[model samples]
Target: MKRGILLIAAMTANVLLSAARADEAAVRAEIVARLPESVGNIAITPDNQLIFSHHPFFSPEIRVAKLTSPTTFQPFPSAEWNTPRKGTYQYLDNVLGLRSDENGVVWIIDMGFRTNITPKLVGWNTRSDRLERIYYMPDPVTRTGSQPQDIVIDQKHRKFYIADENIGPGGDGSHAAIIIIDMDTGRARRVLDGDRSTIPEDLPITVDGKDLTVSAKDGKPSIIKVGCDGITMDVRSEWVYFAPLSGRSIYRVRVADLNDEKLTPPELSAKVERYSDKPNNGGLSIDYAGNLYLTAVESKLVGVIGADRKYSTYLSDAEMVWSDGITASADGYMYVSASQISAAAMFHGGKGENKAPYLIYRFKPLAAGYVSR
Candidate 1:
């Protein structure tokens, strides 16, 4: 009888151990607000505060919010300058792309051609109450009047790397170039121009027991599009890493050659290297150990690309579909916004509209220090 009791106790202990092993820790910051619209980009400041950008269709303009605390976020008191009259000169269209400098200045890029105008980029001063330094993308990167998607700022060099996906506006696979911006002089240059670095991947979905989707952007029964959605500078800042939503492979290139306009297209293409395999990935971030984090799209997970370029799950959950706008902090957390952007009408076979009320999430790269026996 004692042996039977001991066996039952051992089974119970094993079950509990397995459960603990499968558990994941929560972020210190909570999902305080589900924005009425989709927030596509985010950058964490040194002060532990989060500066985010958001906009709704046919909206007034892009709005910025500052997190007062981990669980609370409110608009930065820039009402006077963000208004239509005083701030009318700034980009009125989609501010989908944003990046912050080491000095804490935030750069906002307006895709300019959202409603009626052509695509362009803009800048903002985080130290000020409103967007004080707004400007258009300089010439080299805008040869074909390109579209700006994501940006990464280099504080040491006073430059910004802009990813021109060129697939916007019912896009038909236009130019694929990375624009290097000189913040001090407001100049921009095109690098890796017309290189086949990025390819399209279909948005795979299972609905009503079948793959229900159509290509609204391409007018075909497909979901793939040439993309350059998320970008970030590595810890060393020597190379830039990026991936596309429809891309099957991840690519990176040295910043030194990218900044130099003298390199030819084929030469620049040779410099490009495949980084990883990320489907439906909308964002890229790096940890202190050089592992790359990607939004695993339908996987509802984040995969870390190691130094060997081998991938592993840093964190994942079944509810993680449509994750977007991810960034890593020096402290150890890789923050990502959990927005089911793929389930949107546009992402499927319906209208190209994204559903709103987005949520933010954070995960620890190293196992939670205190979460063990």
Candidate 2:
């Protein structure tokens, strides 16, 4: 009887493992669009129009673009907005993160690192094809080296939560934080600055058997570290999920607590809950069922943290190099951008190994998700 019991237990475990593999295999990545330059992030408008940012790392002349065909794109909103003019904040200086809301407003975050301009949020109305609003993030709200890369729009609360990685010019990821903006009043404030939750772990990220590094101030190679890079909200907009690009864990806090002005910094910090362990990641998006999907950069895969707080591989591809941004669409698919950042020249003795035709791929999620998120 003891031998029979052990045999049954082993067989049961094998069956469970097989089922898990089959589930992952069912979700395959399908190519959505191909571009000559690397893509930083993606957002699909309510009308199903796809929009993305040409990564600032390469200094592309066309900063923001809309896909007109699978292999072609044009300056988004207008060519004038993408053009930079001296002593003016009217144009997009640098952009990385953007999202479309339920009402068809596409919001883009301009980090302004390229020209030292004031970092700001630009919102364009897709339906009207015109400018809607701009919220300037001046000093005290944004410090030197503030690279606000990702954004989470809460239409229900009329607020915008931005993830500032603090990894640019004068930044070394030491002072990462989340900036909150009031949609109605255009008021913005920095929160959780330098908190343990907003900072990167000391862990070094390795990709393709090589350590990802960049030139330090001393002109020596140093492992790249980024803090508070990805941010997202659940379907209910009750909790804000976030993590560092070089972090080993994901953390979140109640949306109410974060917006409550009465709470002190210590009080707000105490409310943050460590959600789950994660690999080094870039962007985050959540499904209606509360499963948080992450762009697992180092592993060349997309990972999901279920409502039960368990992390698992949802989909993967050997060609999926440095997946940077991800967003759920109304068509019941999750879109991802393969930025190929690790292969960029900066990490390879200034000899760029990045190939053209950077890709955007999509896969089905466990549950339906909003397009704006």
Candidate 3:
């Protein structure tokens, strides 16, 4: 009978839908690593070697590490650099921004806030397992209210683009800008000071169905503000894209304009463009085919902005909370770390509630070749 056939077709469609979702879940994201609490950043080299950084905002142990296996990480370079008691001469202070270039070199931006330190860059040759170079930021540059949060390396041009989140000691984030460093000459420049694109307009950061706020001295929840947290460079190394963790928009500018010292900040600001509307996110990554990946912090999703500037949800999982650093690897995988920052004790009264075994996830990128590695 016609009615019986209709029922069978409906049942078949339901089965097919279930199968499709199961297939999607199969490759949603593989749990590549686990930690005790949270990590600030994650980078994978072209050879699929993993490197991660510990955010100075929390514990200072293991400022940088290399994944020997899925769950084990060895302090990258050595334990001295990760230990505060090792004396400040040849050790790392604070490292947040991390990147692995195509040449298998890992670059770290040490904010240098430990003891009395100088902000600098430490490059490690992964192939040789040795420190390659160190470039210290001049006093004038670091004094310009620098709070480097993330970095993007332009290997083709031998330059580095750093995002200054600008959150001060008192938890104020009014100052935000991009710092450019020349790898060849060790010269650094801060651009777009106080510009609209660099500054994060006050906005609520919601996570796990609750707005992330600051805990007052009296245990009251207050608004939390952050600026210019994530950044990335295009495939051709011609453009840079960035976004604020508390913001819902993505911005971009030409590298040519950023490198030109003759132009004033105001003039350079004019060259920056508001690229697209996005969700609150912690990291931005671009693939070689020009697709931009955003780590959606609130919705527990990974959003993608295609060449058309249209936003779409690429992956969604309940486990991805406070999805922090994201890296598009040349191996066709995009890796993300779930720091669960909003659940930390500082924001939840005096008691910390961060659960152990924090997770890192990775999925195949939309297209092939990634920008850096």
Candidate 4:
């Protein structure tokens, strides 16, 4: 009887494992780049070259890079931009998000945190390798506690939606909002300020059998509340989707409502709609088929929300720890970066515990076409 029960349990475990593998995306993970620095975001140029953002956590050098090989990368644009002297605002500082538009424009969002510099969106032409334009975040909007992390560019309307994580110096991301930028005029405005949709829930994030929080010098964990971290646009550029890293629900608003300059903050807030329930997501992207891809941090999975609003697991694995940034490329590939932030020294001691050689994984998307915004 005991042997029969054990055999049955083994068969059940095998069945469950097979089911889990079936739920994974049809295209498997293809390693693109492996670097010692912690990678934050990813972008694929028109020429199929890979570009990545290095989050200012594990190292100070190499803000952005273009993968020249599997293990080495070249500092993008120039080395001067990555190496900033004291009080130099011209250099890139703590860049977290990046996007490659169809127009051969690579948009980079530099969060002015480490150097107290003004945050800005920089557009560089990949073909020419020239800095095309720079739009500074309005001082008034970024005045108090603004950590703009990710961006979504709407080419149809020539606008940019930036997700202001609003995490303070101490890593307390209590305040959150969305900043809208007019690409043509270089003007910016804030919307949904302190609204429920943009705000984070008073909850703790757990990952890998540990709570997602910062560890003090004394080795005690303190909960860090981050809000409004991921932002993405629909295929038609009609809806802009976003969610807080500490929250579980995804929300979106119509692009037309955002373009209306007459709408006040409260009025814009009314236009926000709760889209769907998601896991704690680090990055969000949408395909041409209106499929939303999410790097679900807490669950260590890549989630997909179809056009029908049905939620399902696209990919999941133990090695997908702290999957940070996800982007769908024009070449029918979806790329994701694993930062391993939860295991960093900040959560252990002054000594970072993150393993070296962080990786970027790419896989074929559900449908072929450029990602929406």
Give a tens-digit lDDT track for model 4, residues 1-373.
7534533554454344433332553546777777878899888876677888887666558898888898988888779878878865677888888888876778888887777788888888888889888989966767577888888888889889999888856445666888889989998988876788887888887876767676666877767677898999875678999999888799999999977889887898899999998887889887655667888877767888765565678876566768999987766688899888887776665676678789889876565435435
Question: What would the per-residue lDDT of candidate 1 be over residues 1-373, giving only the tens digit for each residue?
Answer: 7534533554454344333321243323335446555666676655455777663322435365665554455654355434434325543455556656654566666666545444455555555545556556644556443557678877656678887776655554446677777868877677765566743454443422335355565577653455566677665568888766666688888888677677777888888898777555677776544556677665667766655576665576554556677775544465677666566675445664454456777776532110000
Error of 1 at 111 (Å): 0.7
Candidate 3 lDDT tens digits, 1-373: 7534533554454344333332243448788888764777887887888888876668557888878876788898789777766435577778878888877888888887755577888888889888888878766666544678688988778889888887744435566778888989988887876678877778788765567676667878767777888899876688999977778789999989889989887798899999998888888887655667888877777887776677777787787877888997766678898887777777676687667687889888655546363
List candidate 4 segments past 4 Å from native. Answer: 1-27, 86-88, 215-221, 349-351, 369-372
Clashing pairs for model 1 are 201-246, 300-320, 346-352
Relative to the true structure, candidate 1 reaches a TM of: 0.77
Best by lDDT: 2
lDDT of each: 0.60, 0.87, 0.77, 0.78
Candidate 1 yields a Cα-based lDDT of 0.60
- Candidates 1 and 4 compared: the better one by lDDT is 4
* Model 3 poorest 10 in a row by lDDT: 17-26
**For model 2, what is the error of residue 276's alpha carbon versus the real structure, in angstroms, after optimal superposition?**
0.5
In angstroms, the error of model 2 at 360 is: 0.5
For every model shown, the clashing-pair count is 3, 0, 1, 0
Model 1 residue runs over 4 Å out of place are 1-33, 55-62, 67-77, 80-88, 117-121, 128-132, 138-140, 143-145, 199-220, 347-357, 367-373
Better of 2 and 3 by TM-score: 2
